[model samples]
Target: MNYDQLMFNINAYKENNQILDLAKFLVYEFELDHPNLEGFGFRDELEKNSILLTANGDIGERQMVLIPRNLFDFEFNLVINMIAHEMLHVRQKSPEMMLEDKNEREWQAYYEMLFHTNFPNVPDVSDYHKKFFAEKALEYYRRMGEGSELQAKYADQKLKVLSLIDNIQHNQA
Candidate 1:
C-alpha cells in the first residue's frame, strides 16, 4: 500500500493547522533552529494497526514528526505532548554539545512536554492528559528506586508531574 493508505482514518484525519502552527511555534519557542522542519504525519512504516507506538521526529537528517497511526486514537493533547517531547530531544542534541544520558534526555523532554501541558493558554489539553501525567509520575517514581542517578533525575520529573496534576486538580476544584 502507499504511505497515505497506511494511515488510519486518512480521509478523516485532516491535519490540524493549529497543531502544525504550534509545532512551528515550538521550534522557535524552544530555539531548535530547524528551518527545514516540516509538520507531523503518519509514515507507512510506522503504522501498527491499533497498537500505540511512540511518536518520533527526525532531528539530524530532517526536521519533521512521524507519528504512529494508532496514536491518532488518543486525544490531540497526547499527540501534541509527544511532539513537544520529541522536539525537546532535537533541541537537546544540538551540534555544540551532546546529551548522552537517557534519563536526562527523557527528563528534559518530559519537562518541556509538561510545560506545554501546563501552560494555560495551550489548547486541547484534557483530562486524558492529566491521567497520562499521573501515570507517568507513578512510572518515574517506580524508576527512582532503582538507582541513585535515576532517583536524582526521575524524582525531579515525578515532582513536575505531581505539580501538573495538582494544577489540573486545582483548576477543576
Candidate 2:
C-alpha cells in the first residue's frame, strides 16, 4: 500500500471518528523523514479462514502491512486501528530494544495502543475506549500464568479500567 495514501485515508477516518493522538505518536516514533522513506504494501494471498490482520519485514529492509484483499469488509474504525497496531510493531527500534518478557511487551504495547486510541487530548484519557480495551486487557492478563507480578499488576489495572467503563456505561446512575 502507498504509505501516504493509506495514512491519509486512515487519518481522515480517524478525524471523523474521534480525536486520537496516534498521528502525533506516529511522528514521535520516527524522525519525520525516515518513516515514509521506504516501501509499505499489502499481502498477495490470504485464506478466507485466516485471522491475520497485518505483518511486516525488518524495520531496516522494508515494512510491509499485509492486509486482506477485502480490506473494506471491516468497519473503518477496526481497519484503521488494525493498521495503527501494525505501525506500532514497525516503530520498535530493534529486537534488543524490546522488553525481556513477552507478556510485558504486549501489555505495554496494548496499553500504549489504548492510550492513543482512547486519549488524544494529552494528559486526558477518556473512557471512550475503556470498555473495548478493558476487555482486551483482561484477555492479556489472563494469558499470563497465575502468581506472576505482571498478572497481579494488570489485574488491578483491569479492575480500574472496567470500573471506569461501568460508570460510563451506566451513565453514572
For model 2, the stretches where C-alpha displacement exceeds 4 angstroms are 1-39, 44-52, 57-63, 117-130, 152-156
* lDDT of all predictions: 0.52, 0.51
Residue-by-residue lDDT tens digits, candidate 2, 1-173: 45677567656745664233443333333322135223344465466543244435553444455555555444444445555555555554234343345555455555654555332422223455446655666676777877788787677666666676687789846
Clashing pairs in 2: 1-41
Give candidate 2's error at residue 149 in angstroms. 2.6
Clashes of 1: 0
The Cα error of candidate 1 at residue 66, in Å, is 1.7
RMSD (Cα, Å) for all candidates, in order, is 8.2, 8.0
What's each prediction's clash count?
0, 1
TM-scores for candidates 1 onward, in order: 0.52, 0.52
Cα-based RMSD of candidate 2? 8.0
